[model samples]
Target: MKKLLIILLVLTGTTAIKAQTRTADESAIEKTWARFGNSWRNQNFSDMKDYMTPDCHWINVVGMHWRNLKEVQFAHQAFITAFLKDAKAVDKSSNLRFLTNDVAIMYRVTHIGAFYPPDGIDHGTNKQGDKDNIATIVFVRQNGKWLIASGHNSDVVAQAAASDPVLHMNK
Candidate 1:
């Protein structure tokens, strides 16, 4: 009986250690997301660039795609230069899944509001739409830091319906 109790205690202790380690990893990944949001709100495109890998890719709600880091950087720089003079964003992490110790997928919601210069290019159309959307970001730990590997952004309602069975009850 004493031997069985010791074995059980060891198993529980191992589980507790794993849980703590997993929580630490999640917190670190969350910080990466927070940094991405801060970049948008603070207009720090350099930080944004740093958060992504060289071959990182992204597809937006409008079907616009950025295929690589350079392309993403160029687009972000253009927006910052020509618009987004008064841009604000709040990013919240909604869900996370770890595929491996080095890879994670995160779902988040971002609310963005922007005011473009009156004479700026594409001023007639609010390019960002100043609304909330859902984003899925794939992060891979490279050389000890988390960086975005790929991402997709789309309408919140659509994503929620697809992800939540409770929301899809009728259809």
Candidate 2:
């Protein structure tokens, strides 16, 4: 019994150590997201590039796919200049999961202040005067830095009747 207890303690200690290490990685990823949010609000895609991989790909909420860092930067710059110049971005929440020591995925919800749409109408915001989007991002640890490898953003919209859990739960 004493030998078994010692082995269990060692296993528990190893698990604790791994959890601590994962927590640190989670914190680092959160910091990176905060920096990216700041860059977005400031309309500084150049600064945002620092957090992304060179071949990073992004799909915007509207389904536009940017194939590389340069394309992403250029697309954001043009859109911000045209419509979101005065917009504000706030990170609502982030959920991170590690696939491996060097690969992670983050699901982030962001609130964007009211802005003019591409149609020249002030219709970007929702009823709360903020547009909320959920983004799924893939990150890779490269050279001790967490950089975005790819991501896709989608607008959070109201649930339709088909999506109502109460209506489908009985069925």
Candidate 3:
């Protein structure tokens, strides 16, 4: 019985240690995300270019597709200048899944705050007054640094019908 007890303790300790540890890749990815968030808040798309691959693809919340890094930088700069100059991006939560040692996908929920329409334009807001979007970004490690390869952002909408049993069980 004493031997069994010792084995169980050892197993538990191993599990706890593993749970508390994060790989270097995970730490690097987290830092990359922090830098991206900072760039967005600063409205510095030029700095953001360094984080993305030259052939990066991005799809915005409104369904506009940017096919390359140049397009992505240009569109973000224009949009921020015209409408979202004062908007701030707050990352609510994120989950990263690795497909390979060099490739990972991150799903992030971000809140856009301090939003206001430009010059008498009325872009209606939700009841919460702020907007939340979910972004799925693919990151690929190139030359020891992770770079954004592709991404898609979609507005998070609360729909009661989506939770209905009939719709959920359709699959």
Please give the CA lDDT of all the candidate structures. Answer: 0.78, 0.82, 0.80
Alpha-carbon TM-score of each model against the true structure: 0.78, 0.82, 0.75
Which regions of candidate 1 fall more than 4 Å away from where they truly are?
Answer: 114-128, 157-171
**RMSD, each candidate, Å?**
3.8, 3.4, 5.2
Colliding residue pairs in candidate 3? none
Candidate 2, residues 45-120: lDDT per residue as tens digits?
7886789888999999879999989998898878777667777777788788899999999999888776777733
The numbered model that scores best in lDDT is 2
Instruction: Please write out the lDDT profile of model 3 over residues 14-68, one tens digit for every residue.
Output: 8877655437778888888787777777777888767889999999877999999
Model 2, which residues run further than 4 Å from truth? 1-6, 119-129, 159-167
Q: In lDDT terms, how accurate is model 3? A: 0.80
- Number of clashes recorded per candidate: 0, 0, 0
Which candidate tops TM-score? 2
Clashing pairs in 1: none
Give a tens-digit lDDT track for model 1, residues 1-171: 999999999999999999998898888888887777666666667766668899999886668799999887777667655566566667644899999989999988877664554334465664554777788999999988888889898866544566887876885
TM-score-best of 1 and 2: 2
